[model samples]
Target: MKYLSFTTNCVLILSFVYVVNCANILGYFFFPGKSHQFVFQPIWKELALRGHNVTVITTDPLNEDIPNLREINVADSYSVFLNHEFSNVRRESTPPYKMILFYQEVFVDIFKMQMENKEVQDLLELPKNAFDLIILESHNKMAFGWKHKFDAPVVALSSFGLPVFSHYLHGNPIHPILYPDFLSEIRECTTLVDKVESTYFTLSCWFVVKFLIGPEADALARTYFGNDMPYLDDLEKDSMVFINANPIFSDRRPKTPDVMEFSAILPIRDTLTKDLKQILDNAKEGVVYFSLGTNVRFDHVQGDVKKNIMAALGDLPYTVICKWESESIEGQPKNVHLRKWLPQQAVLAHPNVKVFITQGGLQSSEEAIINAVPLVVIPFLGDQPLNAKILKSNGMAETISPKELNRELLRDTILTVARKENYRQRAKELRDIFLDQPQSGVDKVVWWCEYVIRHKGAKHLRSPAADISLYHYFMIDVIAVFILSFYLTFKIIQLVFAIIVGLFRRKPAEAEVSRKKKKKN
Candidate 1:
């Protein structure tokens, strides 16, 4: 009886300690696209699984009842995308600078909707210091004010790579010629024209990010969170940034310690469903998977482009699986199969699965590498072009211009990747590198989240240059001081020389006068 009582007492004490150590975390993802969720959901969900009290303000909510996890659903947040067709947007191929404007307008609309959300407003009304740490998406800068309201440290997350302007958040170096913007076509900067184009893109986008987007973000932050909130730009200070791009295949650019990267954030299944398994396993001729990701709906892919793509797939001897939104395509080939939604990673993991033709979205590219499959990229817009180019350079993929795509070109490209053993071999090498990290991406994210809470923010790990002004960062003041000192020294020496010359002239004049006096005498 005595021993039983002692054991019970020890168990009670341990439980109390566990409860005390659990942190309260709040995560907000502004982008409503499901692809972004693939990178972020695993992170916040894992935190809750680890005994933390996690509450997420998200458009895509896991409506299940999980202990220690609460969902503040902002279902209407996706309304911002309903009006615009991304296929039309891609056709226009908006330049990097103009794309910023387009995104600014779209995000501003989302800001109003999210701020005006009743559940979100109710969340804000809760007691101060309610959260121990805050996780936010980088695209939504205004949400950084939540850090102030809750008095919590922030860990900024990006679904993809950061824009050139956002490099300042972690004091990462910004190089245009070598590390061009993701939206631009200038990947290799061998020519002067390439350098010129990259320079213009970097400078112009920086101006737009600071001047045009800054004021609007500030105003929105002030109105919603509080007028006392710090400037939108400054709120990124002391925050950790995690990018979804892996450094190996990404641009060979400089990175600060604060920036963390990961490729395999989403879960990959080892088994496929009954129907999918049967189809993939029986494909002796091999299999091809094609998808345009979430933004480019299949129904919108009409007229000549659709016809050519279909014609190409029809000619291929292998079985093809495509992610289609509609019930059925009109002229869909007998060899091709369409599913409204399919498990992407599991399908890619099949043995017979060969080359994947895709829109080359970041998540898609990462998945391709993670699954060890070659690619045939038909880039549409945004980072797709850049991702495609990088993959091609790595010997893991081929790039085809969307505007120039036709039956013969599409057919030949897909066949080349599938038949060429090198593409598959290179993909396997890259996949090994991506998975060679010490811990999984999800685990790394969870550890860092807890680290910030334990240390009361990652202030020590922060970049010294992150919070400083641009003039101070560039050492303009220090350079000015040196320049001024040199100028003053030069002027002083000139003055002294002038005085010495004047003294010699005076001596000569006096000597001449004395000579004249003697001669007169």
Candidate 2:
């Protein structure tokens, strides 16, 4: 009896251990940009804190001393971004074509650099190394190769919302009219010409990804993960979930079951530095927060644009806190304060901040909305124009076209947002909606991630359409068959009608000849 009791206790302990085992997760951040890293870092940190075995291949590693957490820093990829980064993207922001070039030339290079990193190469060499799941950035689909390498589930996270190309993975329909392409600057109530252009641009973007980027990425995947692995195209269909950083206020659309919106994952704290607090406290007429986001440098702005901005801010009565990279402004204003970098969220959270002049990146846009600060958006490139348009449409912001930016326009827009009570009211309303969700964004992510681990790849959540080809999904072959059937039916009907008319004409002629012969006799 004693021996049997001891065995029972041992079995119970072993079962408990099996149930409580921590999942081993691998995260791949192929994009080198800081903005992308900012969205991903919080999630990785949270996973580690929860006692999961987390390993990440990223440009911006946590660099913290944490047990059971490994971060492989591929900082070398930043040089590629620096070399390809262009400041004049505003002028060259043509839809679909320019974006295609940017992705093919710049993003492709960044991914390759990350793949060729010493750590990444070493990891690929070890076929025995395993992971429970692989998290990838949606921008670089090449990272999906890890899905096959580890034979694990893929959870794709997009820092800048889901592009039209990615909708296919979730079996989500691409309704061009309602869901405009991120790069296509078409609003819902645009003109006929704009709608046509938007549709063409949207289709063109799909073409580029399908024909240009997709094939090249497949080749790269083959090089790293080997040809024996599932085709790169098929690998994406195996994704468990798509976590997008797209705020609900930005774009309204119907998402499939597998897509999740966790845009509010970033924590918002109202704390500020002592120096910044003193500055804002001293400003009696409120303050204007200005930032062009991380990539665009103020120093690189054209001379005229700089002069116009300087003059506009110089004339404003409010204190201007601009994120300027240069050591000194050409003509400094007494009311304006220049800083190389400021704690953006902390500054925006202040009650004294009247207006936020932003370049309309997704992260900055969410920050602005959450903090209840009105905006004067000056879009530069990518999805900035669309984001700016959305904010303006919602009555929470105003926009000054880059081409039309002058001292007068800049000053007017800022004044309008700062002085207008309606913008602030609308902004506050959005903030409430954002914060009123049933659970925190972090909690939602943690729950879903654990759910995926428990279910082992979450294959039950996947759609059958996700595995189908584009031709089959759209029913191109079915349409062709119908068209051929209709043509054959029309030809048969035409032949029958011609024969009936010929017979009627011959009968009439025969009757006339018979009547003439009777009269002559």
Candidate 3:
């Protein structure tokens, strides 16, 4: 009897410790862009390494295999749409608005299906209170509706720079900073335009989601899950957000209590490839590496643009390695070699690599800074313009308009950027800023994850919702201004009317007095 009692006590203590030590973390990543994977992979890996049970719900399968990584392929068919050659439609495609519409349509259906499906339900219903915390990609605002189902703290991962959705969650003013005034741009100082624009953009986005995409998503949700999710506006106010952008690259904007900035999470590889290293070792002049990034295909570029680029390279005496999709170039120059795939980081690390010509994607930009390579950007679409603008403003890069894709402009810009020592000096300075941060990007993410696990709600750090009302949050100051203006206007108008009445009365009284004086005489 004594022996049996001791064994039972031992079992009970082990069970209690197991429950205490274990933490359940679920990450939801549904963005279509492949670049997001690089940003997310390290965080997931670090969590798993720390002995936390990490499950990643992704749209596509990841190539890297890691223990505790659970990938759920939610919308595999969307890949076909993403990889489709839209450039082949026409030389001058008449407003590809149809593409945006198609994306919205497909996304609404897939998101609804994923949320309502039995498989997802089963996952959600996993042993009672299975997860300690849920980390969602901030871009997937639709997922906010499902947060209530999980009994854990909801943390958001923003892979992009400071976005509106994240800003809203932290109870911060989204307007003035996001939508600065025209004059603000001129002054290069603070303005209310970012706030106004942010407010307008937020409402615009909500309208698009609610009226345009919400009904479809709701109907689909009802059909699949038998529940009506709340409207998009109602859903956005209740989550924590973190942006994956370095402050060094972005304007120094104030952040609310709930919002955090952790960027450049991907591991920096500064080693040179064997082939590139060999070439650089023998090079007398130096190398200039060029790439337009993965999203912008070289084949889609106009023949004239390609020829102009090649012609520009012909003028340069330095060796240029261009990462192209095709093996052959019609007007290939002697100094340029077209490779289907070249180790980008390897080339950047080469001592001979003096300058980088790029499309200014976040990862590539980060890599260039890490490797201390100056840039000449030819941005095409999306956040490329913003990135290019930031880099140019910082004196670390030069932006060349794509319209001026001629030999002379390309050659001149490349030569100027390469020869300018200021660009390299500025890039290295920014690198120092990044290195001086409190912790590595990966380490910060891991620390936050662990901190959430230790603190049940993380409520102490959360920003209050009251601080984020549309009027007060945006700081329209409508009431105070209106009252003050109304009071002043009322006083002015009242004084004017009194003066007019007095003037008429004065004339009548004076006439009566004149008549009385005449009668008396």
Candidate 4:
């Protein structure tokens, strides 16, 4: 009896320990951009640190030898950028659908390459029930089906703010008036016409994703996940939660509780390099930093645009540091300093760095605000225009459309923001607000991640609207019923009135005929 009691205690202790350390997470972040990768890498890093066996298939793989870390690096896809996958994004004023189609074409190729790669395929071919959770980048829908492959719960990573289609996937409310469509340039202060335009853009994007992009992704996923797996579209709706990069400071819109925003995850630099610090410390006239994020390289800019930008920077009294890819920029300004790459967050944090001339990428915009640096944004493609517009609306930045950009305008815009203390003040205010969160972005992600694991994928956190059909979700059929009933009622009333008037007119005509007949008699 004594030996039996001792054995039972040992068994109970062992079970407790196993339960405490039970999570094998697989993260797929195979999007081909540094900015997108930057947003998600930290989440996996923290998960690994917390003793979760985390494996990530990424373009930017882990460099260190961390315990419980596995990486399947497909950096070869960098050639896609070199081959100009995002070229001629806005050569003409293309509509939003065409723009999405263009990106979808590029993304589909990237997805196929990643999945067909031996390493990723090997991971998939592993025995069933391999992982406890799967985190997929929400941009490319191909890998969302990995949930079925591993028989684990899924969590989606949204690099930017959620678009209309993404909201539909997760059952987040998308009010056209309150939240403007992601692609369109409409904002909160829109008129009836603007609302109509925004709603149309939202509907069109939903259709394109459902009929066009969704099918492409579903077919690709079915190819590997087996036809027996739940459809990719269905699996996508079952995502446990969405970790979005949109902070409350960036856009003060309503959000579902299931969506967590880790906006500052990308640019959290606590220290600056010695040389960069020295340059900023010595610049009494102030400093301006310019970089078009990672996607749009400086070398790809047209010669005329480059020349004009250089000339404008040259005229600035402040020292200008630009991220230029070439060894030398022709007609480079005396005051301008060009480097192949600069530590963007460190430079933005410098006290002397006044105005950030950026491509208005969401990460860059958030970084600038976090560091209290105002912006002069030149949006080129994707959601840059929307970011610039909202930042300008918040009075923390000024915008110059690429088409409207010139040497004089660009120079003046930079100087205006640099000299104006209001932009700086507003940026500082937002920075304080952004920093006033209950916990840091890293902490929030790590906590929520563990919570999900502990709760067995946290299905209780999921919104039930995600399971409803699109027609029912939007109440399109209900609206159709109301419209049809009103139309029928209006027709019935019109017919009854016409019949009553005809009867009265016929009686008057009959009386006249009878009087004429009496006269004849």
Candidate 5:
């Protein structure tokens, strides 16, 4: 097996030759977040490599020169993300409602930008039946209209966690409290206050996404796909769903057969730089790897918080490898090495590395688990907090809130995670489970994508719940019927009892009146 190093992400040399029954696949990954693109890229890349014609419209394109692949680059749309200062949102404790509103507004602008692109406009103008299947991203409905334009089957692709409303498309069960949305901070709650808070946040987001954001997105789809386009809600009824989540760390939910969990084995160049490899090898006291992930950069951290983090790490005897995008961090210790980028998976896989200090992004979490490395999570945004909560519950990690981060707390937590054997033990046990899957690397995705195409859409696999109405889903209407029946039954019984008492009273009165008449006579 030959491995090529490209900016630290490694692609496995898949052994299977799946060139038979090649089909044309069109992928629309419109959400500008790099993390979202990460989930969908591998599937399209593999399909292209396996002799299928794969055309993708994305904000983050592969930019690879592979045969059978055509990429429409729309990376300039990433500027929409820079418009928001998420660091301020965290500090101000922005209410969940406002946060979601801001989220939709930003994404709406991105959609407008991408759809208006010359390439996307031209692609949309293509004749019907242009592609056999369409791969669509979750969270927004603007791109879902492609199914109508192309007259093809669509496989839903969810990054990290499936959106709350998308769960309905596949008929998966949803409980605001039991299974919280990824956007919500409270995944599972014990206290009444926590449960109430969870319910509010979850249901509020659910309503917003389904009613406000979804309809707006649908209208935008019409703006592009023509005014007569079918509602995205209708077009979204998919039989095959691919969620970029593995069972190891994802919240426990009963998923239908159609909703399968898979995380593409993050491909990386196998070789590490000589200097870094030597540094890791020579770390006599093990190594601590710190990174804030792409969405949350180290520099975005509060000045005090960044200082405390650096101080905490510098105090540790272990060597620290930090991923800082800037040229350098002031007052950084000699023991702490700074790099603009590191092959995260490669570094985590090192035996000498003790624990990963991360922002708890799904990709970082998956890689850490696969490498059997314990975690020190300081979550920033999106699903990081939820991922941190899951990791802590599973005993594979120690978590610290970004707001409460300090030198003593960060230092102590890292030491606790590193020194303890159970953290590593739990990681290894879960790693075994994650690694013990059939097919090598991305072959599973390639097979599923083709399976949907071969079967001409798998409506049989969709859950019955996805089709049931809200009135029927919770049996609210059925409960109303029962309540109405019981009320009527009780009212009839009360009226009958009153009539019996009235008849008895009338007979007594008639007897008294008869006595009086006899006496008078």
Candidate 6:
């Protein structure tokens, strides 16, 4: 009896320890851009630091060497599509639209490849009950399907701002009016026309994704998995989504239920070099730093636009550091220095660095605000326009459209952004707001990791799959109602016209008989 009791106690203790120690997390990170990788790295590192066995599948290699973090290279076949040839694809003449299409095609193809590859299959074949949780990049929309294959909680990380997704997880509308237009800072309330436009944009995007991208991905997934492919609904059902967005930067941030905005994940390096310290401490004239982001090529800018920016900057008395990739700026001003690469954060932190001329990438925007530097945004593609709009709305930045790139305007905008102390003050205020958040992005992610471990699975918090549908997900029902209403009105008019014609007919039966007699004759 004594021996049996001791054995039972040992068994119970062992089981508890095993449960506590077992945390296997797989992270699917398919973002191709360096900036995106940088944004997500801190959270990934944090998860690893917390003793969770973390696996990262990525297009770009990560810089950190954490023992628990496992790196898997997911090949990107869409290298041919990227506008700027950074590492691969030598040819450079492809049009932007064609390039975008090519990118879509390649992403579908690669997703299929990843789904079908022997290594990936082997990895998935690992006991479905093995992993504690799966974390994926939200942009890899297909990752949502893995929920069924694994007995684990799923989490999505958005490297960009939150908009459509707030509705996906929380069943709440992130009002489009919240995203301010760059040209107009005043709260532009959503109008009927704006709603219509938003509906059209959402539907158009859905149509493209479903008809163009979804079919191929579905076919590939089905072929590899030997089962029906998981649909968009499946993706949404399995995961708790989070956006890397700061409410302080957004114009009118909507309160969301499930999805949380933890934008402070972009970690600032605390330790500064003596030289960097001196640069910040011993500057009489203010400094200006410029970077066009990783994806954008400086050479792609038209000669006139380039000349205009250079000419405008020539008049500015501040020291300018431009991350220009081009061979030479022959008639460059003495105040401007061109470099292939510069210490971006160090420059931003410098007390002398008063203004930032940027491509309006999220990471750059976040960095500027964190370091209390005002912005002059030259937006290119994707979320840059939205970021620019947000910054402009927050009174922290001024945006100049790529189309309106000229020396006078460029100089004027720079002068306006730099001269006005309001932009700087707003940036500082946002910095405080970001810093005051409950926890750093990394810490929030770590907390989630532990929560999943404690709970076994965070299924209680997941939004119901039945609540979301294709038409409902994109708010297509609202559009359909308007269309149906118009059609019904037209049908009613046609019916009334037919009735009126019958009533106006002078002796219908006699007229019909006469017509028949004439036909017989």
Q: lDDT of all predictions, in order shown? A: 0.83, 0.80, 0.67, 0.80, 0.82, 0.68
* Tens digits of per-residue lDDT for model 3, 1-521: 99999999999998877443557888877665556666777787777766778777776556466676666766563454454553333212322234334445645644655665455767766764778888877655566545545557777786666444345556655454444311121113244664554444455544555466556554554443236555534444555667777865554566766577787645643465677677777766988888987667766766678778878887987898888878677767877877787767778877788889998777788888887889999876545656777778878888886766788888888888889899999999988876677788778777776777678756677666534566775457977799889999999999999999999999999999999999999
Ranking by TM-score: 1, 5, 2, 4, 3, 6
The positional error of residue 305 in candidate 6, measured at the CA in angstroms, is 2.6
Error of 6 at 438 (Å): 2.0
Q: Mark the regions of model 1 whose C-alpha exceeds 4 Å error after superposition.
A: 1-20, 88-93, 269-271, 300-303, 496-521
Q: Which candidate tops lDDT? A: 1
Identify the runs in model 4 with alpha carbons over 4 angstroms from their true place.
1-19, 85-92, 243-257, 265-273, 474-521
Structural similarity to truth (TM-score) of each candidate? 0.90, 0.88, 0.75, 0.86, 0.89, 0.74
Query: In model 2, what is the error at residue 256, expressed in angstroms?
Result: 3.0
Local error of candidate 4 at residue 445 (angstroms): 2.1
What is the RMSD, in Å, between candidate 3 and the native fold over all Cα? Answer: 6.4
Q: What lDDT tens digits, residue by residue, belong to model 2 across residues 283-306?
A: 889999989987777656666898
* Residue range 232-290, candidate 4, lDDT tens digits: 77787777555444443234555566766675445453466687677788899999999
lDDT of 1: 0.83
Between candidates 1 and 4, the lDDT winner: 1
As for candidate 1, its clashing pairs are none
Q: Which candidate leads in TM-score?
A: 1
Candidate 6 lDDT over residue span 1-521, tens digit each: 99999999999998877433647888777656668777777777777876778877766656477788887766453353343333221112333234334546655655765665465677787877767788887765566666656756777787875434334435545444544322122234458765554454444444545566556555555554446545654555456667777765544455343566676546555544575455446556787788888777766665577778888888887877778876357899977777776668877877788889998888888889889899999877666766787789889999988777888888888888889999999999988876677767877866776776677656676555336675777779898899999999999999999888878785787789999999999
Model 5, C-alpha of 404: deviation from truth (Å): 1.3
RMSD of each: 3.1, 3.7, 6.4, 4.8, 7.3, 8.7
- lDDT by residue (1-521, candidate 5, tens digit) is 23345423433334433347778889888877666677678888989988899999898888889989999998888787677665545412767767777767877888889888898889988899899998878666677888888889888777778867777667776677788777676667778987887788767777877778888888888877888888888788664777777766566778888887776567653468999999999998999999887777655666688789889999998999998876477788989999988888789989999999998888888889889999999988777888888899889999999888999999999999999999999999988887787765367767877888988887678777777788888899889999999999999999999999999999999999999999999
Cα displacement (Å) at residue 66, model 5: 3.1
Where in model 6 is the C-alpha error above 4 Å? 1-20, 60-65, 73-106, 109-127, 148-151, 163-166, 174-193, 223-229, 250-257, 270-283, 326-329, 464-521
Write the residue-wise lDDT of candidate 1 on 348-450 in tens digits: 8888999899999888888888889999998877778778878898899999987889999999999999999999999999988887777788888788888
